[model samples]
Target chain A: MIKVDNISMRFNLGIEKNFSMKQFVVDLFSPSKRKEKKKKKVNNEFWALKNVSFEVKRGEVMGFVGTNGAGKSTLLKIVAGVMKPTEGKVSVGGNICPMIELGAGFDSELTARENVFLNGAVMGYSRDFLQSKYDEIVDFAELADFMEVPVKNFSSGMIARLAFSIATIVEPEILIVDEILSVGDAAFQKKSEAKMRSMISGGTTVLYVSHSAASIKALCDRVVWIDHGHVKMIGDAKDVCNEYLRSLGLPVEGEGNGA
Target chain B: MIKRVWLNFKKYSFLLKQLVARDFKIKYKRSVLGVLWSVLYPVLMMIVMSIVFSNVFKFTTEGVSYLAYLLSGLVMFNYFSEATNLSMSSVVGNFSLLNKIYIPKYIFPLSKCLVTAINFALTLIPLYVVIIIESFSYPDMKLSLLHLVLPYDYICLFMFTLGVGLILSAVTVFVRDMLYIYGIIVLIWTYLTPIMYDITIISNPILQSLMKLNPLYLYINFARQIILHGWMPTPAYFAACGGSALIVLLIGMAVFKMNQDKFIYYV
Candidate 1:
């Protein structure tokens, strides 16, 4: 089970642009454009998420549907334990296997074989478990012959296949995925979807964020529609996804109206 | 705090091992000499310094061979320099990884420091080689069982380096200025530590006294006592070396803890 209560995330939009002390000092001594900025001690706070809350029950598959910049990824990161929310609390009561940005722990200089072990360790799998699953990962990725080659030499598609293969090797109690279903070529995508279904049916709790409305309707038991950092709607997947797609001026599956 | 750190370390111990090995493999992957480069690097530096200091600076150790004294001080200072320099950028260098998944943020800096620690241990081979060669020349060279205490001194030195490295790594997440300024500070710090010259030759009492306050100076001085003078440190000396390291470590851990939650936002 997972609980997210009253979560908010704030970003200081322009802070990193003026990160240099030399630039600040130079601007301080000058009297032109930056003078007004210096007088106010310069701040640009943008709230990325505001007062949002949700819950995922054990063995439930929940989908998040939103436009770009709707704070879906930020909420996923908070639940994944990578980022701290500015307000509110999140409690996840099981082991998490996050597939946020696949290949997060890979070093390009390392071989595929080495990255399998390193990337697995980063996701909290023990070396022994990874060793036992090594062949399975290679077989699924279909890189058995290329395991010894450095990851830098692998094509982009090959790398993504390897990353996806290493990430889903375990049946985690809580799996937090972020827009990662589209990996490798078309054939590989079908295989990975099958793999995902097996994991979901094996009683794993899932929090999935994706752009594909069909995958959400196919896999999610429930869907949360977020608009501008607010939970716009939450209920059964088919209804919420229909409403979500309709709101964007696209025709719903069983409707004749079009934007 | 200790228990929490131990638990975190235990949980990530395999990750830490891979991180260390990843760097080790990358560093020597393209080189023909492989890890022998670590041993050869200090010996080569010692050769160049031996010529310049002996003839150009004309500095001399009264009863100790300059080669022995020079290499001992160089080995310890080099470890400190490399560890802290690399550790300072550890957090920002792994921005992609840190933002994507949850990692014990300290692991970045800790892994870099551990890699340098391995190289530092290997560099001791060069230092001992110099010691063996100088034993043939310097009549005062007494190869006794007391020299085994060198590894104990290294443990204390490692703690001090890691303490300083932790603080630098955490501070660097917010202040990009530290990245540029640390290079200049290290250059000045090397000159102030008496690594290339004899400290006793300075006539000014206050300047000499201030030099003694440097932690690197204290570490080098402590190791020299075991290697050159064959003297076991007094309990006060032991307490001073170990105590300062412990205090810095406590402060480092505290600073890292307070600032770690804000790191993701900044990085």
Candidate 2:
């Protein structure tokens, strides 16, 4: 179970460029820019999320749908605990296995074999557990022949498959997957979708973010439609998805053919 | 409290091992010299510094050969600098991976320290080699059983460096300028510590006492006392080493914990 209450995320547009200490000190001494920032309302900052409250009960597969920069990724990151909400609190009851970005933890300098253990360790897996599951992860990723090769040399899809295999190795209590079902080639994507279905049906509480209307409708029990960092709509998966499609001027599923 | 900390330690032990191995492996990957560089690095540094200091500075060693004093001081101070520098970058270095998942942030800096500690241990072989070779010139420079307790002082230095590293790594996340500023600070700190010259030459009481306050000095002194003087360090020396290490470590842990939650947002 997860509860995200009144969550808001603020990003400072001004400080992103002035990351160095020298620039920060110069900015401190310069009163004009500082005064101008305060005089103008948002202070060169923008909220990525605003008063977003949601709850996911155990064993529910929730989906997030939105266009680019609609704050879907930020919400998923907050739910996964990779990020903390600016003004609100999130309470999670179970261990979170966040696949926010596939293979984000792997060091390209290390071999595929090394990254498997490294990424697994980051997910709080014991060495013995990874050792026992090592062969399985290698086989599932179909990189058994490439395990000894460094990840830097592997193709992007190979890296993604490897990360997907490591993440799905154990059925986590709570899983947050962000648009990762579309990873790899057609066959591998189908395999991963099947893996996700089994995990979802086997009582794992899942919070998934994906742009594909078909996948969300097929998998998510409920869908949250986010638009411009706010909850635009929230309801049954098919309903919210159709509403989302209509907003985009796209054909709604089963609207003309089956209606 | 200690029991809980020990349990936490036990839980992260495997991760710590992997990170340390990751760093240690990466350092020597595809290198012909491999781990030999760790042994050669200190000796090479000592030779260059020894030549310059002995010839130009013309300092008195008090009793043990100049090489003994210089090698010990070099290894200790170098470990502190190298560990803290690497640790400073560890978090900022892994910010991308960090932003993607949840792992204890402190582990990165701590593992960097452990990696450099391995480097320090390897350097000890050459440190002792220099001492043995120099012993032929100065009989008092001979190795003694007291030297076996060097690990005690080494641990103290490791803790102190780890503490400072944690602070710097956390601070670096906010102020990326620390990456450059620390380089200058390390250089200034190297000259400030009595690594090359005899501490007696300071002459001014205030400056001498000020030098004692530098934690690295205490750790280096503890090692030097055991290795060069060939005697057990006084109880006060032992307490000073342990107390300073624990105190800095506590402060570091406090600062790190306080800032760590905010780190994800900033980075």
Candidate 3:
């Protein structure tokens, strides 16, 4: 469903320029040894994603396991076509619903109902289609009574619930989830996992990035471990999860604590 | 092509409608007279300019009243200032969507123009009342000059606004100083464009030639010619304004498209 080839992203650290001489001189005499610090703030390229390549077949639940700053989110963003890689290419052949950020299209002044339609439109659902799925979305979100209320007034959990409901309402061909399940209460998290499982079973390919090996084992059919923006391994979920857990110094299977 | 913009317009038409309605509501949200603020601003400016310049710059308005002459130019000038200033920050200001979605980037600026157009339309009511009152008061008033309210000038002004807005938006992405510099520029730009004074009042020939080269000067003149002078601009004025707008729009689009890929990184 998606292919990435030698994708890399280099960001310039000293992105802002054209500081005035007065401000520069003021910084030179600041209270906390400013001159030394200012001298070190030169433009440098930091690679967020380095020459990473991978593929996900149709209906495959692919887990992207990586530590913090492992470029997992960057890879997902490239696949979602929101950010272009500085080098190489990422080609995706499906309608992609990227759960990159919750409440991305929500207007604080707008009501929950208005936001659902707006967010659905942003996620590529036409008005008629959103209208068709409206009931199910509201039901899944469990916000039927508060449908007319403004989203800004909703609690953080309510907002996440609504956002997740809108994203999963339509059965997209490719779903890219980044840390979305990390939100909500435990029961809601279980509901989210169930919904994803249902979608995966019915031929929706998913690329889920997470730091939790347990979540990956619970959801994915295949696991692709990434370390420092490079693919570490790609194989069956159990083997990769065992290897990853072993690397983290955790005992495998029955050797662990009470479950 | 116009078709792509046309399609985007159709696609975003509902959002446009909602935003325009919301903008009107938001602008007048707390005021007693609501949208009346739009007309009040230009009317106040017209009165001030007419009072300030009437004694010093004595060019007969042919038969038009001084206030009429001032109002016509004031309306068009407001359109340019409002459109360009709003557009310069329109993209970056809405970084939420610009960073996430893939839609026509020009929509942000274009939407600003559309909102300002609504404001422009509302401002015309006072001008109409002022013109009628002045025409009745002055026996020699050139009623024929009212023909300048033709829709074509509005189109020309809008196109000019769009072209300039796009360029300013693109430039602002690279140089953040533009945000502050443009406030001073608009103040100076209004005087340079002959909004309050007549171009013929300038005794120097070089300044007259230079005014002809200034596209905003030409646009304001085009609006004034139609509304106060009651005649369409010469083919040369049309060619100059249209040609310059097209060139700026093309260059702006090119720069916007080239740098669009880097917006996520920069933002």
Runs off by more than 4 Å, candidate 2 = A17-34, A256-259, B1-11
Model 3: how far residue A126 lies from native, Å: 2.3
Clashing pairs in 3: B148-B226, B148-B227
For A1-259, candidate 1 gives per-residue lDDT tens digits of 9999989988877777667767778887876758666544445776778988888999999999999999999899999989999999999999999998999888999999999999998987889999999999999999999999999999999999999999999989999888888899999999998998899889999999998999899999999998888889999999999999989987778778454
Give model 3's TM-score for chain A to 2 decimal places. Answer: 0.87
Where does candidate 1 stray beyond 4 Å?
Answer: A22-43, A257-259, B1-5
Residue B189 lDDT in candidate 1? 95
Residue-level lDDT of model 1, residues B19-39, one tens digit each, is 999988998888899999999
Ranking by TM-score: 1, 2, 3
Clashing residue pairs in all predictions, respectively, total 0, 0, 2
Reference-based lDDT, residue B149, model 1: 70
lDDT of each model, Cα atoms only?
0.89, 0.88, 0.78
Q: Rank the candidates by DockQ, best first.
A: 1, 2, 3
- Residue runs of model 3 more than 4 Å from their true location after superposition: A17-43, A185-187, A254-259, B1-25, B55-62, B137-149
lDDT of 3 at B184: 99
What docking class should model 1 receive? medium
**Candidate 1: residue pairs that collide:** none
